[model samples]
Target chain A: MTNLTSLTIRQALDGLKKKDFTATELTEAHIKASEAARHLNCYITETFDHARKQAKESDARYASGRAGLLDGVPIAMKDLYCTEGIQTTAASKILEGFKPPYESTVSGNMFRDGAVMLGKANLDEFAMGSSNTTSAYGNVINPWRSEAEPDKQLVPGGSSGGSAAAVAARIAMGATGTDTGGSIRQPAAFCGITGIKPTYGRCSRFGIIAFASSLDQAGPFARTVEDCALLLQSMAGYDPKDSTSVDRPVPEYFKAVGQSVKGLKVGVPKEYRVEGANPEILALWDKGVAMMKDAGAEIVDVSLPHTKYALQTYYVIAPAECSSNLARYDGVRFGLRENTDNGNLNDMYEATRNAGFGKEVKRRILIGTYVLSAGYYDAYYNKARRVRKLIWQDFINAYQKCDVLLTPTAPTPAFAIGENTADPVTMYLNDIFTIPASMAGMPGMSLPVGLSADGLPLGLQLLGKPFEEETVFKAAGALEKAANFTALPQSLMDKAA
Target chain B: MSIDINTVRKVAKLARIRTTDADAEVLSGELNNILSMIEQLNEVKTDGVEPMTSVIEMNLPARADEVTDGDMPDKILSCAPEKAAGFFVVPKVVE
Candidate 1:
């Protein structure tokens, strides 16, 4: 038989229905693949034992003709989700060894539909950095290596890096990811997979560790657009537990996949054509435009004037929210504690946070505290909030001219793990293309469209209006057919061998 | 305005993350770089715009402020680094 892990989530579901393979067999196959890919450091904690039990239960359900949507598909849960009795570190020493007594609403929904947990995937500490290097656990390596230099290790773009890498390597059928600033889509682009950050409040934030309250969103990563749709159907819903979660009916997302993009208005923002982007990436964007036009999508040029200021605005607002949200870690109720024997309360807090948080997390915290500090509040934080409105207005105006927006997911393909660490700003710039949509609370997706001259995957982003994910999926389905990306990471191919 | 070492030290203390003299010196330069990049926001004229409190249009819906969940102190304290008798232990503040 062909490798079980090589099958798409839909194909596996069909195979299980036909009794071609037991759910247990499929789960075991992915466990083996995960064990072999351990050096990629995709998971902070592997739940092999838990998976075996879940798969066995799924087999009984299949026998009883009561199988759930994801009946036995093993998948990775991004460690930011709080899983009961499972250690969920947000890839930070501050959260090290911390196990929540409750499950995040999204992850709980996945298990309710019978998705088996492979483990908690790693991410940037508190989901701070664009590259996964800020992870106190270790850097997540992208499965796709440059053809000329196989020994070089590229980053799986973050802060959702590990979830993307796990799916790209076929160790997990699909994985959950949270996007604060391009966390899901950028990594999906870097790792040659499909991912989406649904509109704000598409998925409940209950029990997921907070980064930035307004901008943070949960989404899915999968090998194909339809697979992402399937994963999202199980993961997204309104929950009273999360106040921001909208009370809307959940649509069957897969129904939107494979739909035609005929008569659709696709926008190409002139501002996204920025200076000094990779020429190959720009060429790929042109190819996407041509492909969409051929598929009957009207290509129109639109302007988002505030695009230039998005990164600057995000750097301020996100840090400000992160600073406020992370204040819960005070060596009082959770995770790591240090200098507790100190006679002073404030001294204990200083010592514990200083010792527990890694450099990047601490840096963001300092920045956040400074911006929200006494003298700088109106100058920095309030200014950023005002600018954020302008950025969102840009999208509101662009949607007036187009049904969907198309752009490159990243300025360049994945860089080597250590290449862009010279300055924090340099790393922050990696998410330039993906951040604007995030800032506006719009639903956006990234799918591998073509390979670069370096033989690494490049992706195009599809953005739709808020709560209008069906249109995004329709256009994505049309592009998936046109691009017909057939390449796989060399490492994944070798691992199967 | 660029942050100096003294500013970094002060802010780190406010964040409750202890910073040493050496760490503050290095962080001041890095923080300055980020702040200067953020300075670009000063150029955009948002004269009459309101600060963004919500990304989407919705009133802050308040739930019935009654007992929604509670009474599971063990569950809440499950991950506590240090706890005793249903409460998280903290350093003594009262002299």
Candidate 2:
């Protein structure tokens, strides 16, 4: 038999149903694969024993004819989500040893639906940086490397880098990721997988470690668009605990995966053709457009003029919200505390934060504080919010002309770990293609369409209107069928060994 | 307008994150770079646009403002670094 790890979630669930493989067998195969791929640094904490227990329970459910939607699926949980009794670090020293007393609504939903967690995946500390290099545990290695520099370590695009890497390496069938400014889609593109950031309010934010409250939304990473559909079906729903969670009915997304895209309007926004982007990436995007057109999707030229201001607007708004949201992490209720030995409250907060947070997080907190500070609030924060509304309006106007927008997931392929870390703005540019959709609260997805000149995977993005993930899934599925991308990161296991 | 080292220190203080003079100097340059890049938003004219509060077009969910669940002091304090007698211990605020 071939590798159980290589099978998609849909395939594995079918195999389990047919008795072709036991849940235990599937889980063990992935555990072995995870052990083999430890060099990727994909996980902050591996829950192998817990996974075995969950698989056993899943097998019991199968025997009892009470299987859930994602029965026996081995998946990676991004560490930002709190798991009761398990240390849920957002890959930061501040959250180093803190374990939540309750579960995040998203993970609880998945677990309730019979998904077995392999571990908490690593991410950018507090989900701050784009390259995954800001993680305190270590930068997650992209399973795919540039053909010219296989020995040079490459970053799995972040802040959802570890989840993307795990799915790409076949260590997990699917994984959860949070996208605030392309955290999921960019990393998925970098790691050669499919990831979606559902529209804002699609997934509840309860107990998920906050980054930028308004921008942050949880989604799934998988090898195939169908698998993402399956995982997202379980992960998304209205939760009373999260006020921002949309109270809309959860559609059976699996039904939408292979739904017809015949005559569907697919928008090609002109502004996304950022100057100085790689010619190869642009070429591949053209190929994606061609593939969709061939699949009978109506290709329409659309305008999203506010796109150029999106990154700057996101920089201001995200940090402003992040500053407000992260204010709870003082040396107080939970997480790390420094200078506890008779230090004043203010001193302890200052010391613990300075000692606990990494450079990037501190940089953001400072930036957020500055923008939201007195005299600067109207200048930076309010202006950015107004521009954010403009970005949203741009999507609204474009959606009038099309059902979904198509573009390159990232401007370029994955780069070496240290390549963009010297300057913060350069790292921020990685999200330019993915962030606009995030800002507008539209559902966006990335699916591998082609390889770059350097032989790394390049993905094409599909953005749908708010709560229109079903449309995004249909477009992505049509494109996926046309691209037929089946290439694996063949040498990743060899390096792991 | 780019930030200087003093602005960095002031922001750090406002953020309650202690920074040494050396770190502040370095952070000043990084913050200046980030802030300068963010300054591009000034180019866009947002004369009458309202600041966005939430992306989801929904009214603030109104529930009866009443206590839902409480009384597990042990569970709540379990995460507290310093706690005693069902109370979270903090530095002497009144001292």
RMSD of each: 1.0, 1.3
Structural similarity to truth (TM-score) of each candidate: 0.99, 0.98
Q: Could you report the DockQ of all the candidates, in the order they appear?
A: 0.86, 0.86
For model 1, how does the per-residue alpha-carbon lDDT over A1-497 read when each residue is reduced to its tens digit? 76899899999999998999999999999999999999999999999999999999999999999999999999999999999999999998988888889889999999999999999999999988878998889999999999888899999999999999999998999999999989999999999999999999899999999999999999999999999999998989989999899989889999999888888999999999998878999999999999999999999999999999999999999999999999999988888888646568899999989999999888888899999999899999999999999999999999999999999999999999898889989999988888899889999999999998889999999999999998999999999999999899989777558
Can you tell me which runs of candidate 1 are displaced by over 4 Å? none
TM-score of chain B of each: 0.91, 0.92
Candidate 1 pairs with clashing backbones:
none
Scoring only the second chain, what is candidate 2's TM-score? 0.92
lDDT of 2 by residue, A111-227 (tens): 999999999999999999888999999989988877887798888999999999999998999999999999999999999999999999999999999999999999999999999
lDDT of 2 at A342: 68
Question: lDDT of model 1 at residue A115?
Answer: 96
Residue-level lDDT of model 2, residues B1-95, one tens digit each, is 98999999899999999899999999999988998899989899999999998887788889998999998889988888888888988788685
lDDT of 1 by residue, B8-94 (tens): 988998899988999999999999999999999999999999998778788777888699789998888878877898888887878
Error of 2 at B60 (Å): 0.4
Q: Give Cα distance to truth, residue A42, candidate 2, Å.
A: 0.5
Model 1 interface RMSD, in angstroms? 1.0
